[model samples]
Target: MSQQDARIDAYIRKSASFAQPVLEHMRALVHKACPEVEETIKWGMPYFTYKGQLFCCFAAFKAHCSFIFWKGALMDDPDNIFQQRGENGMGQLGKITSLKDLPSDRTFIKYLKAAATLSTSDLPPATKKAAPVKKALEVPDWLLSAIKKNKKAWATFDAFSYSNKKEYVDWIVSAKTDATRDSRLADALTWMAEGKIRNWKYVK
Candidate 1:
């Protein structure tokens, strides 16, 4: 048996006239495709869940509607129906203004079954790649000594966050000549003593 939500019914009724039939048809198609599929509202949109996990979601905007698979990036799309990544639409199929924009009922159900299979599988859904770790910044001994010579500069530099400290260190280290390094170091100590970060000039 399929579970449906009254809130979704009201939602469809409240949608723009052009989107009502499109939403209704898709809603029926989802239930027809997966008899065990359960419906609810998530993020103010109609959400379908299967086997205790998110199956998919759909929303009707002012001018168009969208249908998204929860694990769309992991699904196989041999039919080439999915929108290319980084496109404008929030849904895999892009902005669906009418029924003609959708794949045939058979193809749509096939992918719906594929999504249901993924929900039933033991493997976890795909996650974004982990951000790369930033390497530790090493302060040059001469720069350290120069900062230490001024108690206020040392205090300010010591209080700076890792990112703030890294900015100053990176700027000084990237200097091409010994003279430029010394000049920047002097200016850096002066700014630190005044409790200013590197690139303070750009700050509003």
Candidate 2:
């Protein structure tokens, strides 16, 4: 049987007065549509899980409440309910400040039920996702010159993984001052000469 989470109850109770009703309305439809859905808090907000994955989540902000179907990207948004990728927070319905800002109860139930159904489906393929691809890390000329000074360091660096090389590059470039950058480079070269990856302390 579907039931309310006391934590979710407390979350709504502590939210702003205006948001209380919106949260309550959404919460009711979630349970109504999917009696087996489970509710929990994730990233400081309420989320629903079905079929072992995050199905949807909601949050109360200072001026608005955000709601999202986590797998909405994979679902058929025939009503165009989802906004363009990366508009605000994780929510696709936009900022729901008032109950009127939300989609109608029937539409919401459709979304909730669809989300539950999606959790059991194969879902969207990773290639269709809108996420940006990471660019290849470039070795700065000055840092390259320093590494080349020691044959052992250069040889070790040449064989490092892209992520390992990025770690060294990022560490040196992220230094707040010239002295700090140079110090990091010197330490980085020394570690590399000994055939150590960046973040060697965490290596296990």
Candidate 3:
């Protein structure tokens, strides 16, 4: 088993009763169908990967869990086991609370195998391309001056990721007035100098 599998197994071992068996069963089915599937943790959830792409993931929550087939939109589900709750690039069958809520092991295994085959054999549709990251708002004159005045903050902000930079800029630009913007900028510069993202301290 891969390190990710071990970690997932550990998670299941400590999870609430309703989640344990569900995740364990899904884990078994995934490995059985795709013997070469590698495991990894993504966004703090267990994910299985094959052919350089993620195949599927199972996540546990307070009341239910979700089985997400990454390329599920491409598969033909004759039994309608793949639930279509929203948009279609991925498919989810959630609110799974017990073993009986799942499709038969054999059927679920087939879905996993088919999903893996589709991911390996075909190019994803245009809608599946990763979305471009949004740009930050233009830096205001005052905010620019603050950064220039603080050498350490200027250096830190320059090295921030596009998303991080956008967060700081948006926070300041969203202020209702120049006075509010100026007040926020002072605190923003102090946080940036410490290499923190906007709202970093408040983020969970």
Instruction: Find the candidate with the highest TM-score and give its number.
Output: 1
Estimated TM-score for each candidate:
0.66, 0.60, 0.57
Q: Superposing all C-alpha atoms, what RMSD in Å does each candidate have to the true structure?
A: 8.0, 12.7, 12.3
Residues 1-204 of candidate 3: C-alpha lDDT, one tens digit per residue: 433457777778777898898888888889888988988888888888887788788888888878888767667788888667332323367578888888998999888998788777765722545798767557778777878899989999989888788888888889999899888888888998888888787988
Estimate, for each residue in 88-182, the C-alpha lDDT of model 2 and write its tens digit: 37477888899998888898889899888877777552234468776667888888888889899999998888888889999998999999998
Report every candidate's CA lDDT: 0.87, 0.83, 0.79
lDDT comparing candidate 2 with the true structure = 0.83
Over 4 Å off, model 3: 1-4, 85-91, 125-204
- Higher-scoring candidate on lDDT, 1 or 2: 1
Candidate 2 residue runs with Cα over 4 Å from true position? 86-90, 124-204
CA shift of 97, model 2, Å: 0.3
| Model 1: lowest-lDDT 10 consecutive positions | 83-92
State the weakest 10-residue window (summed lDDT) of model 2: 121-130
Query: What is the Cα-based lDDT of residue 121 in candidate 1?
Result: 77
